[model samples]
Target: MTVVAPPTLAPPPPPGAYKDPKASAVASRAWRWLWLPLLILVLVIAGASVVFIVDLDSSDTGTLNPHSYRPDGGNALRVLTEQYGTPVDTPSTSADALKAGLGGDVTLLIPDTAPLSVRTIQSLKALPPSTRVVLLAPDRGALHVLFPDLDFGDFPATSPVAPNCDAPEAKAAGSIDFDGAGYLPKTIHAAHVTSCYQGGLLLVSDSTGPEFALLGDANLLTNEHLTGYGHAALGINLLSTHSRVEWLYLDQPESASSEGGDGSQALFPPWVDAASLYLILAGVLVALWQARRLGVPVPEPLPVVVRSAETVEGRARLYRRAGARKLAAESLRGGALARITPALGLGADPDPRALIIALAQRSGRTTQEIHRLLYSPPPTDDQGLLALATELDRLVDDYLTQLTIGRAGADQGNNPEGPQQ
Candidate 1:
């Protein structure tokens, strides 16, 4: 009996079979992410270029050259955030200062907006028990809960100066040419330091509740501003004097900061750990080998990264097309001989077959002596190269004598003695 045919169900349409206008709009909007951040970053950086130029060329900014910045120590903020333009606060401490005289807690704040972040609050709260709070620019009514008795001495934000440290750092302190220029102004009024509170940071110390030493200027830290500014010397003193120093580089816009370093002595790279002597030797060898090779010259310190497999693959394609298999084989053979012949102390250009014959002759080896080893056929494919290696290894024992003296009687020694009597 014949069966009746049934109708088949149609499959559901593929995802988004019909492009909804809303969905299309969303997809189009998503593509903007590919370039929007980059475009905005370019614009921002371009705009920031002016600040950089001002920091570099203007007087009272560059800390490296005495003429760049006035000897006034008051505008430390401008020196930090505007002058040198380095991300880290240059007014804080110098490396030498850190080693020579650094002492006590180093507190700093770069503030923005009225509402302090909870994380910042927690970090400030977590200061060591013996630390003191140092308010750079404390805004009135903003941190009333934290600093009720803060001494606001109404210090001026800036002071006039020559191209060097012109005054004592404090009433009792001696001034040092922190920047290249010898002139460093005496302590500017601390009010400038308190101003950062208007922005966001409230650098607090656990030891000193209210009367902490305040540095009003951040100009010493900016990359463009600090070069000629006495910023460098000021930092050195702080760093040298402090027992333990911490650098918290805050990204004001992001309300985030990162550590320049934590306590650690080893500056070695991770690759220094070698598993064995061979590994250590190999690593050293690789480095030495690389150092000797003069690759493409680069103006900067950045390395020239290469993909070996890709390069080889490209070369291999060319080789295969040109049918240079025989030439390739000869080149490999020459290399093998250079290594093997010298190792055995044989003639520099000793033929493999001739060397084998000489070994057989010295030991009085019969035609049947290791016949399989000597007469083994070369493989037909690319694997033929392996046969040459395997046979060479097998003959090394019989040919040792040939390498040292001369192979005159190796074949007889290796031959099966007539009957084993």
Candidate 2:
């Protein structure tokens, strides 16, 4: 009646107890160095962030900004305009510019980088006839917004040209820089347009609307080029004509509505759409023509029975007609090796030396004879090829006969009784 104690099972060995030492060392080394790459990645991201922040801060002083002090900024021109007794109002948005223009006798300075909305265009068109509007480097889209009858013409001259026109502003600011687009009038309204600086500057004094001045280049007003030639005089003359100037300064690009009519489709020729449709249709037709397949393969019986021996003989005759003695010798030798290697218990790709040794041992032939019969150069003529084929057949037959005798002898020895005593 004694209490018996139960035997406890041994605790399981620690995890990965049987893992290979090499694999364990590799895993340990991997984990130990894992933090190095992570540290590098973090430093790279931090460095990139610092660079991006510096660039972003520098970008605030952009081109055409009236208050920007950078070389590309228009701060100098703004100071000159103010010094001429005309106060400049910096407006970053189109709405603010239009609102500023509401005051009596204000000049609206629109840079090419300013985003023009339809509402802003219409509002500018409705301004008082006395309010002057100056457009700097206006592209075709902006021109269409203001003057539907005008488009960009030939490229402007690279060198500065004289202001030969009779316009009072061009006459006063003689020999201004003209290194941008030139204008061409498309309709009868061309009569009202006065061009200066070789068509680089245009003044449209339409009796029915406000006076418009188009400056083909923005470089003329930048701080870097303001003092060059008569650029300062031209900028001050155009902008200071009114008592107040509304300068549009855009820090970032604004997204304009599609109604502004700057679509890429207008750039292509009229026949492009039709040609694209025809090409697409032709491609589809070609794909269908090539992809159509006949019905699944149909297996049929041969009309006549052909033996394997006949097939081999036919192939041999073809080789002989083609004068392929080397190829014929190779085939005969390869067939002999294929049959003998398996009977000798050698692998499909046994070493050449080992195979020659095994063949010599089994057939009682010299290694040189076996090697020559198997690995010698191909025959040069039909008679040599025939002799080589005969030798290969004899080698294969002798190997097989030796293999049969060895197996029969082993079987008799294992039978335990004397053979038919």
Candidate 3:
């Protein structure tokens, strides 16, 4: 009997992304081994994309979590859009547009009601003198809380540029003439913006040459400000005076690997966010391994997941113990065919004679007969069943050997994962 290779077709593309018939690969004697690597690849991809979206694992950079704000949406993209009714553009982003927004442009950024970080404060302070300034950051670290109920009369009416406000911080902030005198710049969206939160410091600085406006907190830029209840208008109003004003938005990127959190006192110390991932992986693996051992439900037994192979193995063992070889052989043949038909391009209900004819036509098989070798009666005894299993085994080996050559050809850069086997 001479064995020949089957017809070669173009290799299939990736599965799931593009559902190909090839993805439902035909199985054989050693076919189960391939799924182990496939399963591992799937697990790795799922774990990486879903889990590391924000809580990344890298030592160099930090994550800029868009969703971590006190409110649901306080990320840089939303911040720029809601504030200016436009996409983001900043000194760092589009420097060419700088001259357009300068020269009598005034813009304000209030971190008052929200928590304002020291870095945020320094960045805001770095604006030009012509730009207006308002220091509304309260104790929350970012300007999140704005004083609404507080009366103007109750305000100290003194220069708040002392230790608390940006007064002393101005020198370090490197503002031009911020150490000198200047008048308060008014904004169109003041009352509406102010109504949302408490008041912070009102600063007047140069945004560009001849441009000026206010800077302070409606609440203050806090990490905890909720959506639809923010003082975004106040920031816009501060910038409204500019004939052509641009908000110098400082946005944190979304996929950073490192960031600061409550890690100092975290229970897991060095691995704050990674603990949950490990626990889930361990649990899933344990469940799969112990699925059969606890297949028959008992009182207080944990859950498990049984793969098709394990289920088959369990049934085979039971049949052997009961001395039912014929039944066992029938099951074994059915399982083996279930894997092979798809692999060899024979339909699910392939007639053994037709399969032989097709194989002969496609791969030039000459005298290899698969009738008694494939669809014989179930074994009547232990020896017969073992013989049937052995026949099934050889058929599987031949099919796989042919499949390996096909795979090798497909992988010469013309295909991705070789021919679907």
Candidate 4:
């Protein structure tokens, strides 16, 4: 008798507590397999990044590089020069260019003059008088250092202009594409300067010095422009004058000190830029994917509820504040007509005469009074508008009441019990 069972203490389970074991197992299996697709996506992104970095570093590509096959490169011009029976030599440094230029009768072509150092400029000044030096879009400082008698006066003309000078090269080339800086001779030495294409091309020569030719636009020699308007003839004429040509393709400015010359002065490797660009693009794609919604938007109930009477009163207040009495009267008249017309069994666009007659016969009001209430001119003042609204409400109420009474009388006549004796 003392070993009685203890009462059960757990509560009963809620309704629908059971779930499909098969479905639960399927969900768990799907979650476990999600990592396969995730791993594949990560591997694809990493592989693409590696390929992009490898491709970017695989070639020596630049704007004016003679070996670059890009549109803005000088590879086409270089090929054309070779085809025209002139030997072309690409010098990597200022020393190499100076040595090549001084070795024999060679034409030195400098596409960019920003990296030229003072020592290089001095060395160029000491070259033989027979050597021809071509400068593409040189700035004022370089021109001052190399030729003190000439400088850039104004912006160069970008449109095609006829060669207005008597130079044999300009006459042969005719109208060359002009998109470079213009040159002007110093007042004292204006006689020594020979200009063409409105000063877009200049030639400076003295009896005891090397000849200097300044081309205002460097795009004239680019592969993209070489085939356009007299560009091929102009480029060939300038660079192919001598049997040998030396092109100075300097990527960076020469360091003045010998201590920092061993390593490059760039802040980061070239692949870093490509990698950063790819990472930014990947981040954008991930953000867009994660932010995508699954289906059409679901409408939610408004947080606050507003009553119809309050809304009408608010609109009335606004109309009164704006002094729109005529508009208020028109709205009141229109609402009354719409309700009364439907009750009178009239069509949507009933004849105006028939509508007036129906309202007049039902409400015992004159046809003119019904017409005035329904279709009169709008009110001019607030008092007139209020009067119009009150009249309209009275008219609609009378018409509906008369209609109900008529229906009730007709029903009583047809009833067998005879008027609820």
Clash totals for all models, in order? 102, 0, 71, 1
After superposition on all C-alphas, the RMSD of every candidate to the true structure, in Å, is: 27.2, 18.0, 20.6, 22.7
Q: What are the TM-scores, per candidate, against the unseen true structure?
A: 0.25, 0.47, 0.32, 0.48
For model 1, what is the C-alpha lDDT against the true structure?
A: 0.39
Q: Candidate 3's residue-wise lDDT over 1-421, tens digit each?
A: 2334454433222222221122223333246678798899999999888777755532112112232343322354236444655333334322223333334244343222133334334344344555544333233233222222322212223432332333333323221111222222233223222211112334322323222222332222233332222233333344344443343333432121111233234445667458877999999999898874545656774488778899878987899899976556656666666766786676777655555555444332332334455444456777888877886787667666666665656555586555688
Candidate 1 local Cα displacement, residue 418, angstroms: 89
Top candidate when judged by TM-score against the true structure:
4
Better of 3 and 4 by lDDT: 4
Clashing pairs in 2: none
Runs of candidate 2 with Cα error greater than 4 angstroms are 1-56, 156-158, 185-191, 255-421
Kindly indicate the candidate among 2 and 3 with the higher lDDT.
Answer: 2
Give lDDT tens digits, candidate 1, residues 226-286: 4444545544333323233233222232232322232121455555554456797999999
Per-residue lDDT for 1-421 in model 2, tens only? 1222222323322333322223334675687689799889999999999999998787648777787788889889999989989999887567677766766588998865356655567667777777888988876766677778776777655566888788877789888666788776434273377888877888876655677888888888899999888899999999988889988876655544422344455668989999999999999999999989889999999899999999999999999999977667667876787788786667776766667767777786776677678776677888889898899889888878777777777777688575676
Displacement of residue 225 (Cα, Å) in model 3 is 12
**Once model 2 is optimally superposed onto the true structure by TM-score, how far is the C-alpha of residue 378 displaced, in angstroms?**
83
Give the distance in Å from residue 29's predicted Cα in candidate 1 to where it truly belongs.
28
Q: Tens digits of per-residue lDDT for model 4 on 243-290?
A: 788998876787543122333436467788799899999999999999
